[model samples]
Every structure is written in structure tokens, then in C-alpha cells.
Target: MRRLRPVRGKERRKKPIHDGCFEIRNPARLLVVAPRVPCPVKSEHISDAVASVIGPDFTIAFQPIVDLELREVFAHEALVRGLHGEGAYEVLGKVQAHHRFAFHEACRVKSIEMASMLGMRSRLSLNVAPNDIAGPAECFHTAIRTAERVGFPVDRLMFELTEGEPVADLPALAATFRSFQRFGFTSAIDDFGAAYAGFELLAAFQPDVVKLDVSFVRDIHLSAVRFTIVKGFVAICDELRIQVIAEGVEAPEEVDVLRRLGVRLFQGFLFARPGTAVLPEVAWDAA
Candidate 1:
């Protein structure tokens, strides 16, 4: 008996969504976004969807997740929305409280389709549980295939893997990471400081990118301790050459500190609000 090489890189059937390459014949199952709200999309996803909240603009903004130099962040995190209803975060509490986990998947799938359709030259950062990665490989494969069909670069797209959910087996985890990598999709360890993995994930998984949790970024100026803490990570990241994208950027003072400290890459309300244009009119400089 022989074991598989994890994944044998096979050309499975594709439901191209764009041109001859993009397809989404079988989209993923989203469980949160309510179709009752107006969504600027049309698909065979749910039995019936209301209208699209997105206007005729057909634009999904990508706030730059950039270095301290103030460069534009090309990697836009895929945000979840509930069409014309309230924002996703508010609805999150409601859904979680009501235990509407089933609807959540349906919502997520719709969001992905909308974002992918609007993607252009930037990576759409989609939040995913570590469990999702370990779950049925078919789903993830579907995501990659869908991206290809939608004319989005799978390699450029970063799956923002939030911390939590213990890895039952280290080997299995590594194998999964490799599978996504092989598909040209990169993984990011979101909220790096919040997780205990810290250096462990860096050494084990060697993620392509690491997002500095927003907590440290919030009150960075008044706290020198935060500077020391973030500086240390920046030093290691510089050595590894792995880009450090700081989330939750708000104040010019905080950006000043992060820039001086040698930590590059930032994303937060200061730069541009989520759902706004990718690069705002703000005169932020990478220098």
C-alpha cells in the first residue's frame, strides 16, 4: 500500500466564473449574509435573494495594508456584509447569539462571490478559521477554483487565518498549509500578537505574512512598552523578509511611531475605512 503525496496537483473540473478561466458553477455555502438585503449580485446561491445593497458603482474598496513608508496596501481583506441590512459585525453578535451558524456559511459564500467579482490587482483577504482549513479540502479547493474562474489571482489573495482552534496534529496542519500554498494561495497569521503561537507559527508554518493585532496598534503613542514589543517583532520580520502588515492604524502619531520603529505595512481606520476605495485621498507617504 502506498500513501498519497498529500495532494497530487490534479486538474479537477472547473466551473469557470470569468472568461474561459473563471468559473463558479458550484459556489461555496455561505451561512450569514441574509439575502433579504439588497446585494449587488445575482447567482443561484440561495433559493431567493432580496435586492443588492451595493449601488451601481460595482466597486469594492481595498485599503492598503502597507509598510510604514505609507505605501498603498494592495492586499484588501475580504469583508462580510449583509446587503442593505446593518454591518456584518453587528449582525455577527445576533447570529452567534441566535446560533444561526447554518445561515453564516451561505452569507460567507455570497460575500466571496461579490468580492471576487470586484477584485482588481489586489489580494482579497478572506477570514477563515483554522478549522476551515482542516475541514473538507473540497471547500478550499472550491474557493481557489472559484477565484480562478472570477479572474482573481489566487496567489495574490491572502487567507487571513485568525488564531485559535488548536492544531490536533502538527503534521496534518503542515500538510494543509502546503496544499493551499501549492494552489498559489498564501496564508497569513492574523492577529499575530494575540495568538500564543508567535514564533512557533513563524518557525512551523512560515506564513507569507503576519498581521500585528490591532490592540497594540490602538494606543501605540502613549505606550513605549508597545513600541518595544512591536519593535522586536519587526526586527525578526525584517530578518526573515516576511512583510509585516500592522492592522488598526488610526492616528498619525501611531503611524509615525510604527514608521520610526522600522515596522512597515499598516491597515486601519486612519488610512481608509473598510469598504471605501482601495487608496483614499489621504496624503500618506511611505517615506
Candidate 2:
């Protein structure tokens, strides 16, 4: 099984929000910029030689996870962006197998630093690989310290595990999640329906949230088959007591169908594109 990779990246070149503190429409999610554009390259120690091997310069862009019934921002998923605003794969592609550990650590701490600097009050979600975090406490030393340094509570952070990486050892992965939970950090399974992550892992690990893949949510209103599948999936999650967040929701009709099927949480370009400095302004058509 290929190791699951880390993701969630973007950037903005804008003014600081009101003297280094800015408020989004949802006060819970704040985006603070310095007097000039703050550099996202907080991990200067990673070294240019090592970084050249890993790929281009790195930064972060945040995309909002929204709650429709409450009509407020629920959380921000931090994505990795290259200096030229390349996507996660572009940044990640440069990393070789041996450097993954360092790359993952760099991205995690960088996300925390930027989020904390921006005063993100909502839950901040960072992508992590099961392979990289099988021993959570030992692996999380940098993250924990960075959180404390930035005054961001561990509980306010959520680690996202994309299903793209299949787990080689279920028990070990579950233990890792347990370790993280013990430390007050939350967890979620990203791109849940897009891959082979299914009942076996769900029964074993039981993440706090399952992000429904965009394939399921895209044009859902147009497909009765999709509607039925997602509808049933929602029921299963309700019974299991796991929260479901629909991802890649781009149309108003998609939101309507998802709401009818009982998915309250959502993320997609319809609300806002991932932004570098501030939370993208949500149009609030669903509200």
C-alpha cells in the first residue's frame, strides 16, 4: 500500500487585517496578516539544500469547512502551496521517500504557526500520514511545541488522514489515533469515499469525522444513484455516531440535496477558493 500523503495548501498577498488582527464574516475564523505580507516560510531551519531536494519554497492556503444549518464557518483545512501557488502534489512530488518525514513535519508546524499567527479560532485541520504518525507522541514533538509557542490549543486542531494512503497496520494506526486523542487533538478521514477506506478501518479507528469525497458530492443532485448512496451513507454514519462533512460541493443544488440527506457540514469552491491571507468570502447562497 502506498503511504497516504499530506495535503491542504494555498497563499495570499494582501494587507494585514487591521493591525495584524483580521476578522472574517465568521468571527470564529480569523485571518491575521502582518503590516507587510507575512512570510509563510516559518521553518527556516529546513535549509535550502534539503528544500531543493523536496521541491520549491512552501506556503499555506486555507479553505473553509462550513456548517450550513448553523450557517457559520466550522473549520479551516490548511493546504500546502508552493511559492508559485502550486498544489499539494506539486510541492509533495519533489520529496523523495526518505525525506517524507521531514517534509511532513515541516508542513505540520508551518500550518500551526500560520494559523496561530492569523488568530484562527475555529478548528484548524492539518493533513497527516498514518505512516508518519504511527507513534503520535514521539512524532508530534514538533507539533506540540509549535502549538504551545503559538498559543494554539491542541484541542482546536484536527489532523486529517486522507484515504489515498492505505494502512499497512490497522492496530498501529488506531493506536496512533488514540494517542492523539489522549492529547486532546481531534481526527478525521479525508477523501473518504474516493478510495478503499471503508467499514474495516472505520470500525477499527472511528475518526471524529469522515470527509465524503468530492466524487460523491459532485453533481449529486443530478444522479439518483448518488443520492441514494450518500443518503444511505449518511444514515450509517448517524448510527455509528460519526460526523460527515461533504467535500467538493460546487453547486447550490448539491447543497440542497446534501442537506436533505442530513449532511450539515460542507467544503468546496462554491463557498470560496482557498486563500493565502484571508478566509475567502463565502457567498452564503445556501444560507
Candidate 3:
């Protein structure tokens, strides 16, 4: 494991991009809100098993989310990486059905631990497979215990339902998200425009945040159709009062168009590349 430099400065809570937007940062130092608990997930043992089952080579990375208007970091999304800092696909491809659940649980614990070690004060976004956790109360409980063990507040966690994996049961997923919300955890529909149950999921369950898929954001400034679609999507989110973040943004032109269409939060190479075990600060440019 790579040792990270001690993060300097206190975490501070800033004004939110929109009312009801639950973005928070604490102006405090490394606070062991509580001593480590015996994580109910038994993540340690499971991680060892998972590594053996898959390949003993995997880790986590973080990519910063920027508040375009403020030109500051809003949150850091926890991503999976290979042991050698290879791409996510390389790490994720090693997962098999037999150990997928264990890998998922272990990833959760690792992300929390790494974030806490780095003194991350803002919300930590974690990805989850909706199908794997569709109906497990134990899964949720274990996650809560894991956070408590690391002193990471449940309120500062955002669970993103990835679009890559298609969910079989919408009702079950919605119920799970509701349960998380009840426990002070926020939900997000990631890869919004390109996923299964795209519009249907929105109608059934309104996530606190919606990340526009890369397909829509790619070369958007040059395409009137993409612009129109994104603009309409932004309008609907505004009415529904859901925050939107444009992901995979790589060009200045794309950022310009997205900002004009009421998008204030963005995540992509344009702001900062994903960092392994390190929190990369945002290099602001006029947006």
C-alpha cells in the first residue's frame, strides 16, 4: 500500500449548489468520531478470500468532482483500480460471480478506510451493483457498521447505482434506496442517459443526483440534438429538484455547453484525472 501525505487544512462546509442539495464538508481535522468497531461485514477475512479468488491485485482510486461556478472541489468519487494502478476495467474484470459479493463488500470497506486516511471531509461517492444488494438487509447493516468502524458518517456517503449492470427488480432496488435514505445516505443514478431502466428508473425512484452519461456529454457543444436533450434533462431535474453532474467531460467546449444548460457540478479528465490513494486538487479554468 502507498502512504499518502498528511492532508493539510481543515474541512469546511460551503454553500450548496442548490437548495436541498446535500453536499457537505466539515471544517475539522482527522476526527476519530469513534474507535474502530468489529465491522459486521468481516471485510478483512472476505478481502483476503476475494483476493485469492480473484487475483491478489486490486485497489481504489479517487476522482474529484468540481463545482463549476465556485471552481472548487465538491466531492471525490471512489473508483476501483488494479494493484499496479491499472485501469478500472483491468481490476473489475477479475471479479467472478462466486466472489462478486465479497469483492463488493470489501471495496466498500476499503473506500471508507482510504478516504478516512486521506482526511476526506466532503461526501464520498461509492458505486454499488443494484442486483447484488437488491434484497439483503445484512448487506446494508454491514455497510453501516463499516462506516462506523472508520468514523465515516453515513450522511457523508453517497451510493451510486451504476448503469453498467442491469437491475432485474426495480421495486426491490427502490425499496433499498429508500431504506438508505431513511438512514441518512443519499442515492444517485449514475450514467443516466445510457443505462437500463433509464427513464423508468427516474419515474420510479428519484435519486438525489443524476450523472449525465458520457455519450451525451461528448462533443455536445457541436451537436444541437445532444444540446437539446441535455437541456431538457436539466429542466426536468430542476423541476424534480435533483442535482445534476456531467461526467466524462474532457473538452472546454463541452464544459461551456453544460454550464449554460444549468449544470454546476462536473467530473471528468477536464478537471482532474483519477488519483490512486491521493486526493488531487482541482485546477480551475474559466468555465
Strongest candidate by TM-score: 2
lDDT for each residue of candidate 3 in 88-194, tens digit (9 for 90 to 100):
77777767777787777778777887777677766788888877774536546555556657777556677888887777888888887876665445678889978
Assess each prediction's global lDDT (C-alpha) against the native.
0.55, 0.72, 0.71
> RMSD (Cα, Å) of candidate 2?
9.5
Segments of candidate 2 deviating more than 4 angstroms:
1-56
Clashes of each: 41, 9, 2
- How many angstroms is residue 31 displaced in model 2 relative to the true structure, after the best TM-score fit? 14
lDDT of 1 by residue, 105-222 (tens): 4444544566555533445677665555444264365555555556554545566676755545666665666655554555678888785546666677766677888888888888
lDDT at residue 202 of model 3 (Cα atoms): 91
Reference-based lDDT, residue 220, model 3: 98
| Per-model TM-score versus the true fold | 0.69, 0.82, 0.81
Q: Summarize candidate 2's per-residue lDDT along 196-253 as a digit string, tens digits.
A: 6777778887777889988889889999999999999988888877789999888899
User: Distance (Å) between predicted and true CA of 177, model 2?
Assistant: 1.1
Give me the runs in candidate 3 sitting further than 4 Å from their true place.
1-48
